[model samples]
Target chain A: MPNATVAGITVDRNDEGFFTDPNQWTEAMAPELARSEGIDELTDDHWRVLKFMRSEYAQKGTGPTVRVLGKTSGVSIKELYQLFPKGPAKTAAKIAGIPKPRGCI
Target chain B: MTSRIVILGGGTGGTLTANRLRRLYGADEAAITVVDQDDRHVYQPGLLFVPFGLAHTDDIVRPRARQLHEGIEFIESAIDHVDIEAGEVRLGNGVTLGYDVLVVATGARLVPEETEGLLGPAWMDSVFTFYTPEGAAALGAALATFDRGRLVVNVVDMPIKCPVAPLEFCFLADWYFTERGIRDRVQITYATPLDGAFTKPIAAAQLGGMLNARGIEIVTEFNTGEVVPGGRLTGYDGREVQFDLAVVIPLHGGATYVGRSPGLGDELDFVPTDEHTLQSKAASNIFVIGDAANVPASKAGSVTHFEGETLVDNVRRFLTGEPLEAGFDGHANCFIETGFHKALLIDFNYDTEPVPGHYPSPVGLPLLKESRLNHLGKLLFQSVYWHGLLPGRDLPGLGSNMPTAGKHLPVPEKD
Candidate 1:
């Protein structure tokens, strides 16, 4: 419930970094957030996947599942992993101004 | 006074060791007693099948007392601690036991709480483990509703019981979802702290290829530091893996009683044992076997089967004031389930890794390769485990030491 400042943003995050207030995430904080996750640069392909997750979550109130992302997000599951390393969905959710999608991937 | 033997634990090791020692010393020469926390003796390997509905919980569990020899005593009580210097053990029920020879076989205990946030909000909801009967049953139900998303099977750390089990789970999951007609909807992943699929190169090469054939993604060197309820696994190095369903194999340590008994165990409470003799390094009169021993060999049933020969012989030698034979070679045999009505078998010892070969006979079961014959052999072992194995009856030609009679060992490639 506490708001911790991460990547120059005063954001509320759970202990494991699930965002409490999705609105606290700003475009300005993404580069630092990306650096913390071991991604040196967020390329155009990464944005395509990240924006797809954000647009899907804003409409459905939940991020797209891995299968849905592979089929509809213009990126395959293998490609999604290449974009976000170990955790594609959760990591994308963090940077896309969305709460960590609840209830298993 | 009759030379009394006290075996701590009622699992595969204790049951077999107690029975074997009784046969070796006869009723008049020695008295054997086995102690455990409960009467439930589970066929541990069968737990893997439970999640897929291939094995029932009741079918895999039996009374611990029923496995012992006729004259051996079965104590249905929890152990408080053992006083090694005093040669006595105190039970939680206020019972005291004294032994001329002590056998510590109280195998590894699952420690999920050791990992940060593992027992968190999604403990049994999305995050489930199949290492225990209850966990397996819960995962079965979770998998029933789970038709989509990334399903990850992660082994928390190394030196876990049944090392191949996590890989076996991944293989079976492929078959399970395929049979359910929703294989394409679900994504399968296997995450381990190890650098590869298995410990040995030859077997890992084959098994790793099998995983790729099934389209299951492999996440190697993933040392999970925590599990968040939102279906995320965080690694020690700050990487993370997200999953819809997670089947976790937690770290294992020696039993709690081992910690209470001073000078009896390693830092992890696994008894520091001589690999060849099965005798505890702590004391000459004490011996350790099965998963309880801090041996380099696997903590599996076949290791206990092979150790029984040398362990019983050493007990007899100790009673008669003779030198103990360093007969055990840390031989281990494992049958890995690759799903789809086939399995792979491997045989090894302290020196040899699994290679292409035949076991026992030159034309016997295939090694390091999947075959229907190996699958049948694995299924047949349930009966053998109950009848021949626990009774300490050794299969002829299957000795404590490994043989290279028919194995095809390739020369090491230049680095």
Candidate 2:
């Protein structure tokens, strides 16, 4: 784990740069994190998915899977990919400052 | 009148809980009954070995009723729905059983139909899953004749029982082919939805390395959306992994009864449970165990065995009007069978990731490394599961909580 300053706020992150603690994330940091993940801007659609990911992580210990986010996040699966290219659920979770959704080891 | 306790499912968790509870209460105090649709209780772990011709259906399957203690009752009937408000479990046969405490151990159900085209024309002929007796037997026949081609093992989604089995299948397949002198002909690939070979970082790196050394390709973060008839797994993200033969671990959900009984389960039909207490969020009188509870631990048999101690104690306390003990720590111990009579053991809990060490005691079985001793331990566990674990007898040096004495803690890296 390592601490890095993003958007002028320090936060703890894992080796893959995912947040070790979800509470360290703030709205101000979303844009910079989004930028790092290749998103030039945080659109209203991006925020919707990110907010959903954060809230779901708050409820469940882990983040939601793509199927889960597509079903419940009010974002169509196609649009989710449009919002966050490649892996929507995983990439969105990265921007939202949450650990990647995982299977139990 | 004796307090009636009805347990759902006659599988691992249900059998152990009923037997354990019977030991705690006299027949005059608590009348324990375990119910399932059929009398067959399959040693689920043996299913992993079935495809490799190491075990047979007869070797794993046993009568569910035979495992229960003398005082415990066993009923073979389909669970229709649970009326939580009325405190009754309605059977498909039109019988109603009332209970003061309901232990929901009805484990995870395989939903192969959930995935698009998974059960298509190519099913069984080329695309196979070894999760069930029928599936395993069919796969065994298929693998016997499978001489050359790319063999892909794909895990459709998460929360599956025995998450390590697919990886084990890959390792065993490599050995199985090598033994048949077709190792060079058959190409093996492991595709999973997770970001790595495993969920944990360290274990993922280690397992990933093993797969590489064995010449098995790993495709990570690939969520299977559709399985084309001839031979391709199309990801939702439009990536594809082609295979000549595919062994798929389909999506899993809680038993259908959970979906029928409103307010009983979550969106996925798993009972929302207290991770520490094993008590269902549905009601105070209902307790959940094994894969049925949406806990963060691996849905392995070792997890159910570890949960048994805390769950039984909590059930006793809940019935006697005592405060329930939040004793369960999501301890899960699993043995990953690599090829050639070698296996890797991992012991972990909710807070701790598995590291190199020994389990149960400092001198006990080695952990997080492959060895012949762990393979023997894996084989010997079948007997332990039947004679010891299912009967609810406590094993010396092994308890509900994870032991820390033998485990080597990772040194903290300076920031």
User: What's the chain B TM-score of candidate 2?
Assistant: 0.98
Fnat for every candidate: 0.00, 0.57
lDDT of all predictions, in order shown? 0.85, 0.90
For candidate 2, lDDT tens digit of each residue in B192-230? Answer: 988788888788899999999999999997888899977
List-wise, what DockQ does each model earn?
0.02, 0.52
Q: Which parts of model 2 are misplaced by more than 4 Å?
A: A1-12, A20-29, A41-44, A76-79, B412-415
What would the per-residue lDDT of candidate 1 be over residues B152-263, giving only the tens digit for each residue? 9998876788899899999999999999999999999999876678877788788889899999999886767789878899885578999989999997879998888888
Total backbone collisions, model 2:
0
Off by over 4 Å in 1: A1-105, B412-415
Give residue B32's lDDT in candidate 1 (0 to 100). Answer: 92
Evaluated at residue B80, the lDDT of candidate 1 is 87
